[model samples]
Target: MTGPLITDWSAVSPYGIGRAAFEEGFRSGRTTSVPLENEDWLVGERADTEACLVPGFVIKEVLGKKGTRAMDRVTGLVVTTVGRLLDTTGGPLPSEDPDEDTALVLGTTHGSHKSMVDITRDTLTDEKPYYINTAHIPNAIGNASAGMCAIWYGLKGPNATIAAGRNSGIATLNYGRRLLATGRARTVLCGAAEEYTTDRSWLEWHTRGADETGTVLGEGCAMVQLRAPAADGRGDDDALAEVLGVSSGITGPDGVAAGLETVVGNALRRAGIGREEVWAVSASAPAGEAGRQELKALDALFGDLDPLTLGRPGQIGDTGAATSAFQVVATLTAAQDSARAAGRVAVLTSVDRDGALGCALLRMR
Candidate 1:
């Protein structure tokens, strides 16, 4: 079956993401991080202890009068962002024809940590179950975040949640594109959101390993709407960017650089574009050697092509699985904003695990 095209996408980041605040941080090159001074890292075993969070979150918009007490802040982010995305896109969500197709999928590495950690604390201190657990339970199902999205939007068919460490978001897109291709759903909502608050310091400690430097945590959520092919030239209405192609893999024995060459080479071949044609690059890399490794690979793939870093993920810290997927979304948003008078094709690349990598080609419509 023919795959659907990504029609509309919107983002809600911690640093006032996708809005004026995020643009300021982006242009000024100012870091949104703070030293991990007052954080309680007693539970953090091996993770990097420091963190960077969005200074002010306009979360009250969603929880206006209801409050965020019912679920984790991260979970709230997922629902709120998707809701905003729907508001902005004005898609065919609750159409008169109930058969009108739509899909919802969310990617997250730390979905309910705020609640999970609270439950853990309670389990450690008392013989009774924690209230946080009770609160998070309804939305705590593995599919809770996406489930909330489906229920809120009344989306039917193929609603799923994805988790692959920092690569979950991109992976969700890969899977969702296929869902569209197979005709399981026509318009699809793809997203990734993560929450790493102070309470989940243990996760940070473990993730940091023996090192205490370069650890900063961030949380944000994003959603996208994918549109199917035009039938009688009616609904190809708002195709933002065609899913030209998707290719993912890890580097070979030589090094991370070699691994990326193989990944990008294959994707370029699939998209029928040349190396020199890619105009921008959105890298999904944290700080330290890992980020450099990504840069090394970028150099290898399009050594001479102009590349851009959305800044060090470590600076803003890792927002768990939602990092890379948001990276992809930001690049597309940036390219879309820049396409008014330019001829540029963008590349979104993400590297995870020992060599697991994902790359996609997006072009202006």
Candidate 2:
């Protein structure tokens, strides 16, 4: 069966806010990393002092003062990104009611590590153990960002948040496809968001442990509006692309290349497309050995195909859970610019540290 169609999308990224900014930055081929000037984002003296941050993204300033007193960075990014997407569709805003058949799915490593850590710290350091701030309690949960998006936008359909590290975006797309296939909803806002925070920076520093070139963490959100296939087969005229198939797998550290190869092959087979038909490829070029393994796998699979290869991490830094979604957006942007990219397949592959790997195929319209 044909997959769901991506009709609209948007982003609040480090290059700047909105889809136009992201597209321009991507086309210019410039890196978004800048010296970390926000002292609040610094954890320890040795923490990496550089990152990719969305410019002028203060929560209260962006979303207004009401209902944002306790909003965390991740939630703000999600809310803003989704709102921008809805605006592009010329659909109803939060002030006006949205379609009841519209659902939402957001992917992230965790809701807000900073909020969780701060809440825990407050509980321990306060005069009494229960004296922690009650306003922060909700933002500390893993599903807070996704839940807040639904509540903020008045999206009343099935809402969900997926936490699969760097592969979360692809997982989210697959989940949205399933929702449409099952008639769970008519439209699904599928996306992912990640935040740069002191606690999160420290966690990554410890996780990487002494890599000479430290991981440059970044913050942003990217979302796409997915609609169920049209009965009259006329939706393709308005679609950015058709979700062909998605496949995932798990493997040990040493099996990265083989694992990716397995998933990509499976995904293409499910899409009923030959490998040679692929016109472009997007890779989650994570840092270190895993990244090397991922590249090796892609090279082995499509080296002879000579498809256009797109890598976003070199420009946007490591966005964690939002990486895959950004990859999807990047693919769509490139496909729109190149006549050769239309009517061809594009493949996206990702690998996470915890043995998770996934691949997705999209047929550009």
Candidate 3:
């Protein structure tokens, strides 16, 4: 069950607005966090925690001011990221009338908590229950970002959104795989997005108990262009990586490590690759309790192999829904640049605190 080939990718992250920025940040190996502002803290001590945010993301500069009046942060992040992909694949915008078989499947933790909270608070605190801006109400839902991409880009094919917390990278990739495998689409723009809003930052700090020794909350969107592999079984010389297989699982209480082992083993088996063949491991286990459980799971699977391990949370911060996708990007970049990592098989695994685990096997092409 080989998955669709990941032909290209683009991102808008804390580092900057494209793959170059992300790669530069990763190469520098510098911590990209800033002290949480007074209002940015809702649960943790300001001195002990920090946040990774895209420093000056202006929608008008990225997409112009036409439809931004009612756009939410999630929508802006997605549209801009997708726009960059389009810039590389074709032009900055889709053709006046492009293929209708193209699809979009985006993953997220939750779509724009700021929009949801803002709309909800407006309805409660306003003079009237309906006094909130009705025009932007649609932005409050989780699927709004995906739907907005279709509307803005004129992608008139299957459009969907999946929520699987940090495991969303493989979740969205698997869903997009179905769309391509079932012949429902010729191309898929698949990715995950998370915005570093005040509410989102506060929630991560409060819920995850993130501190100096834990995952720092970050924000960004990472998307890849996927399509059926060539019949000749050949990829472009510049292809980032070839997807072998992707699998996901959900665990009960105290089953996180076991669940991760199951999914990773399944993905490797389906790909017909042995554990010894894996040359690198991209793990999305942020620091703290969850990170410890993830490490335990990896040890169970690859303790003997001892592949090169890569984790970018400390550099990119925990990107929430975008963490695993950025991990994929990080993995590919490492495979591309590092002599030790180049032209090797890599396994990317992700685990979320809410019981979801996912793994994707990739081979540098």
Candidate 4:
């Protein structure tokens, strides 16, 4: 079956808001990093990791006051990014009519970690158990951002959220693909959002060692409009790339090489293509051990082919749940640019901390 098409996309990252800034950063291979403050309290020493944060982000400017009073940063990012997608597409997904056939499916790792922690801490520290403001309760759940978008944007179709750790982008795209294939929705907004909070940085440092001085913790949101190819067999000028297929599997770190090879092979087989045909790969090979294992796997699979790769997480830092989505955005940017001839065919491969190896194949049309 023909897969969905990525008709439009928008992103809000540390580099800046909107897709233009993100694409420029990817094209130039630039890193947006700044020293994070308050790390001494958490790490007991000067924090090693730099941070990439969305500067000057104000939810009141985007959504006004009443509704955003309780909104979390993750929700704000998704809402703003999707708002941009709507603007770029000229409101293709009807916002007035609640019955319009549009879906919102998002992916994230520890989606509401910060928000949840805040409310819990409040509940405990307060003198009275009920002293905690109940308004903060809604945004503490993993699906809060997606649910908030559905309500705020009037998207009345399937509103779902997945907590697939770092493999969320792959899961979200495949979920949208299924929705299109089954005729469940006319269009789907598939994306992921993550925020860089002090708690998150501390958690990353304690658990994953992701906050080491050289490590950069990046935060952002990316969303793409996905739908079946047009009936006329032609897509709009904004069409970035055609989704071919997605493959995902689970394995331990020791088995990542073997699992990745199998996942890549399966993705290619599903796309009815071969290794040589894949001109480039947008890899999630962040720095350190994960990057090494991923490179070893790629080398073993394609030998000397050495497929052109794009967007190492070090450039954007460790984006967690939003990392893969950013990779997709980067790949689409390269594919649509005239200079990258080999960008015609590309694959997105990621290995999440949960031992999930995911791959997605795409071709510029």
Better model by lDDT, 1 or 3?
Answer: 3
User: What are the lDDT figures for the candidates, one per model?
Assistant: 0.64, 0.87, 0.80, 0.78
Give the distance in Å from residue 314's predicted Cα in candidate 2 to where it truly belongs.
5.9
When summed lDDT is taken over every stretch of 10 residues in candidate 2, the lowest stretch is 88-97
Residue-level lDDT of model 4, residues 1-365, one tens digit each, is 55688988999988788988888777777777877663332333333456787766776765567678878889888988988887732132335657469999999886667788888888899998778878888888889899878876788889989887777887899999999889999999998889877778777777764523356788899999998887777555556778889999976555877888889889998789877777777778765666666777877876577667674743667888998888888877776664554335687889875578898888776
lDDT of 2 by residue, 1-365 (tens): 66899998999999888999999988888888888765453555536688888987888778888888888999999989998998832222363665689899999998899999999999899999999989999999999988887777778889999999999999999999999989999999999999988788887887783442667888899999998778878646889999999999997555999989999999988788998789998999888777888889999999899999987543888999999999999999999888888889999999887789999899999
Give the per-residue lDDT digits (tens) of candidate 3, residues 132-194: 998778988899998888877778779999898998887888888889999999889889999
lDDT of 3: 0.80
Clashing pairs in model 4?
Answer: 48-213, 49-213
Better structure of 3 and 4 per lDDT: 3
Off by over 4 Å in 1: 1-3, 17-28, 34-50, 58-61, 88-100, 128-133, 209-212, 231-237, 307-316, 336-344, 353-355
**Clash totals for all models, in order?**
12, 0, 0, 2
Poorly placed runs, candidate 4 (over 4 Å): 38-49, 88-96, 209-213, 235-238, 252-254, 338-343
In model 2, what is the error at residue 68, expressed in angstroms? 0.5
Write model 1 residue lDDT over 228-343, tens digit each, in one string. 67766566657666666678886677776677767877888977887767777777875456667777878777667655544443235567678776776666556545744134
